[model samples]
Target: MNEQKPIKVILVLGLFSFLSALSGSSTSLAIPKIALSLEISSGLATWVLQSGLITTTIFLVAFGHMGDLLSKNFIFFSGGIAFTIGSAITGIAPTFSLIIIGRIIQAFGSSMIMANSMGIVSDYFPDKKRAQALSYISMFISAGSISGPAAGGFIMSVSSWRWIYLINVPLMIAVLIFGHHALPIPKVSIKQLKSATQGANWMGQGLFTAGIIIFFLSGAIFQSRSNWLIGLITLVVGGALTIYSFYQDDVANLPWISPKILHNRPYLVSIMALLLVMLVNSVSNILLPFYFQSYGLMTPFQSGLLIMLQSLVMLVLSPFAGYLADRVNRQLMTIIGLVILTVSQIGYLLYPAGMNLTRIIIPIVINGIGMAFFLSPNNALTMGLVDKSLTGIAGSLNSFSRTIGMTIGISFGSSILFALLPNVDQITPALGETFLSAFRGVFYVAIAISSLASIMVFVRYLRAKKTA
Candidate 1:
């Protein structure tokens, strides 16, 4: 611990965190292009998205387990290598099948990185410094996600979408080489390792992984509303598996994630708030570009340019929010954030059809500020609430909440969307008013969801007050 500084570890982890986000978001913009180039169907290209998320969600806890039982940086380093190799493979792959394989590998690597990020950060930084450092991770991730479309667009303009995947390799290699020596490793005893390994609920883990993937596949990619029988059957099966896995883990002599985490009121509430917010947030992410295009306010690329405003706001405010979090009530900031988010949703709801840029930027900027304030403080508070030994599992589950929120958010949002505008194919000019009505309808749902999140945060806040 003495040999190297905590900042180095944070810097390296932060960079990798940035890269992982970049890899996912950047690739998203390339999906249609990739499908076109490979001469594959859109349905097949959907798998390109699903594969990475499925693999990431599946391996999160397992890799989190490794973070604790093995080494945090070791997991981090290995993940970086896996991501780089996967990126290289995808960059050059001649076949769609090969690209899917590469995506899985890349996403698996992302799981490893995400599952351990908080654990590594926790290991290095003390309480006073931890929140601020955690803020750094959020900033980088925001920067990467916001920049992704632009990066992909630019790459495709000059070279190819393949270059976007390849972009990850060089930076990753440098991080790996430098971090090979610089990152700190928490010392683990032989006894500790043996105990954690023995206590692992392998059966529960298997069921959980399989259940989530199948469930996600059923509910999100192919829903019962669309595919009726197939979706319904798989959803039921997956739900059952997931429930049984938890039940099994509950009675097991040893649970992979500490049962205490579930029982922790502050942690659970805070984590739920984070998840709920992300859930609504993802709606905006998916809907906005298309909405802008429909309104003739901007092209998809131009809307992306406007959205850079939100990301810029997040990147700017997060550190400042974190600094305030350490000084004041974290939950207060959280509540403020959620409130602002609801306002933003209202902004979207009241968004006039064919509105000017001023109208557009207001809601976008508000949403960004809300997100920046909420995420880091909530993370710092959640991590703070957990025991040191459970940080790996806690962190992974934390990451899981964000991942799952993002994963299902689009589904939740789009389901309502399609329900509202079932007959409408595209938001054409003739149907623009109808589509705008439906769009406002979706934001109404977003507002309701945002309210639910706000209540959760309030509950958590009240509990903290009572305790204090």
Candidate 2:
């Protein structure tokens, strides 16, 4: 590695990752305004978020494998170019369908960046400094997550929602220029290149994509039909295809999620815990905007401000959390973070509809701190469990788990709310009672899940100690 130049390259790529990551959530705050302008229903507007997620879900792992097979720098630059074009499309889109299409393209670009970012870091940093480098990258991610909503709100307040998409263009252009110059290329011998080509897993990629499509489609079916039988069949079919893909990869020695990583006890347990953490965090994020808009009787901007509070807290605390993780017992930090997170969720459940803003802000800040604590440690531990050779795959798996968890959490949380408060029409009335009941139900489920995650962490800790 060309040490000095490579560090510059890694920082630039990290910035690219940060910006792409921000695009997803930045548009989230604009959803209500966009829906109103386009005369679309909330259900339809939700497609804006789901479209990006679906695209990313389908392509993340496949792109990760592609990164390993092709040049990582090439894939990263391609993602940047694609992201810029998609942003332009979204900015000028006239119809809701067009916007969704743009979002899908944008998500595809984001997944490309996500799929190869860790590999870029690994290429630049030696083993000793890699943890700290990862922590810095994670800080950027946390910053993006926090800044997106705030930036969205500010842009929408001053200009049209289109500006949110438009802003990414310049950002992407900068990334393209910097990345093209800065990204490091690994030299490979002709024989090594030939071996890599033979090892690439095209079939595994196809099966994984098919399985994700089926999984998402099945979710849509469940929402529409509300029938257990149909869901059961879908689940069985999807599960079988997923299993078959795994079996093929194992037998073929292809680049599907390496079985060795999955079989590692610490790695598996950490992934599960990280999934649960993401599920709860994402559900809370989705809920907060709805809570402010519907129950708190706030405008879109106000609701966005409320959501931004958590992100801001996360931005401030994440670097410290990452630093702490380097020195402390990672599992202990995760457990403590989850406990705090559960407590904050409970606070949200208990929040009276008519309560003052000050009261709500306290719990929101607490939730944010918990999130900051959880994300860094959980991520550090998950990555630390694997050898450097599999970092790209491990990162892809981590991203996949979080995406799956977010989808499940949002769906399940919405289901709980609908099931509990079927009669509440406007979502503004009975300010204290109705919303609280529904939110409480969601919290109960989240708490249970967090508790289970805690147990898993403890068990892993004990086992690790014994082995040591």
Candidate 3:
């Protein structure tokens, strides 16, 4: 397995991960600018981001299936090129609809990259060193998150928001050119080859994609509380379709989830842990920015700096976490990380309103440290349990879990925040208490979720220990 080191493969994967992360975080920063330029409401402008996320959610598993059947290099190369084209479209779009179309295209490409990168890494690296390679993947993701807001702000200050999308083109081209010679060709199993020849189950693909889109659409619409009938219909239909698709696949003796992955208890628990973490993190990501800027009265740049602090901590600790994952018990690392994350959420919930930067930084920094400890090791553990042939679906499932969690977090958290403080458009002395109350309610829920994740990890660790 280790005839040639996979330095280049890891590099290419890291860059792709970086691009995806960068675009997500930066887009949030550009939302206001985009709204202003398009003469659209801020709420409407969010579609630019949501469209991409929704497209990614719909296509992740499909692309992962393709990764199992297609040449990994080809998938990787095509994803980069497609992302470049999508970015270019967004850069010069004359209308918001076009921008959204561009985003959907970009996300389709991102799905291909995000879906396959980890599987490709798992293929080339031996188990002993795989965690270290995965850590680099986590590191670039953190770097992208850390850089996005600052980069977006800088671009907005000097140029147009269009530059943010445009920026990805050059970076993607670099990856495409370099990755051609760099990424190793995957060794396909006979089963995979057969599946490749037969091609994917297009009907199953459509059902799953439609289900996901419907679910997200319902959630988005429900958040506004303006269209209950449509949302209810969507929720019912989507749930039914999703279940039917899963049943159909299982009955047919083939499924995107494959019985191996679906039956692995450790992998399942690990996914649960990862999902909870992303859910809470995404909630915090949405809330803290508003809290800092609206309540704390910080400048947008200043708030970006505060928001970046957590990712910065995550970036610094990811490699060290990787080193420990290789040497230490991965389950132990996960439990500790979850504990820290739960505690950090508690810290945020209890932190007093009108606190200065120092107090805000402490809890966020702790959250970052917890994330740093959790993600890479947990990822390694998840991938370690799956068969090599199933890694494509496995990687995609992991990314999809993250997407689902983030969607839930943002949708639910934003709903609660607005419901609590519907009139809170500005920071005033009298409205401060109301805002704090809403913030506390949202984060208290986040704490519950994080704590639940911690408990899940603890139980898994104990089970493994007992079995050992």
Winner by TM-score: 1
Q: Which ten residues in a row have the lowest lDDT in candidate 2?
A: 123-132
Clashing pairs in 2: none
Query: What are the per-residue Cα lDDT tens digits for candidate 1 across 253-366?
Result: 877667888778789888778778988999998778767776564777787788788889999998998898888888898899999999999998877777577998999999
Instruction: Encode model 3's per-residue lDDT on 217-306: one tens digit a residue.
Output: 887777777776887898789878876876666555446668777678889899878989999998888888778777777777777778
lDDT of 1 at 392: 88
TM-score of 3: 0.92
TM-score for candidate 1, please give it. Answer: 0.93
Tens digit of per-residue lDDT, candidate 2, span 1-468: 555786676578668868876887787778898899899987688788888888887777766666766666666677788888889998899999899889888888888788877766666665445545666777677678778877887898899999999999998898787766777545557786567667667797678777766776666665554674776687668757866876777666665667777677788787788789888887787677667877767886777668778877887787788778877888888888888888887777777767478778887898888877877778777777777777777777777777878877776566566567665555774556767777778888887887888788888778778988
> After superposition, which runs of candidate 3 have C-alpha atoms over 4 Å from their true positions?
1-4, 185-199, 227-244, 422-429
Candidate 3 or 2, higher lDDT? 3
Task: Tell me which residue pairs clash in candidate 1.
Answer: none
Question: Candidate 1: which stretches are off by over 4 Å?
Answer: 1-4, 185-199, 220-225, 228-233
Candidate 3 RMSD computed on C-alpha atoms after optimal superposition onto the true structure: 2.9
TM-score of each: 0.93, 0.87, 0.92
Pick by TM-score: 2 or 3, better one: 3
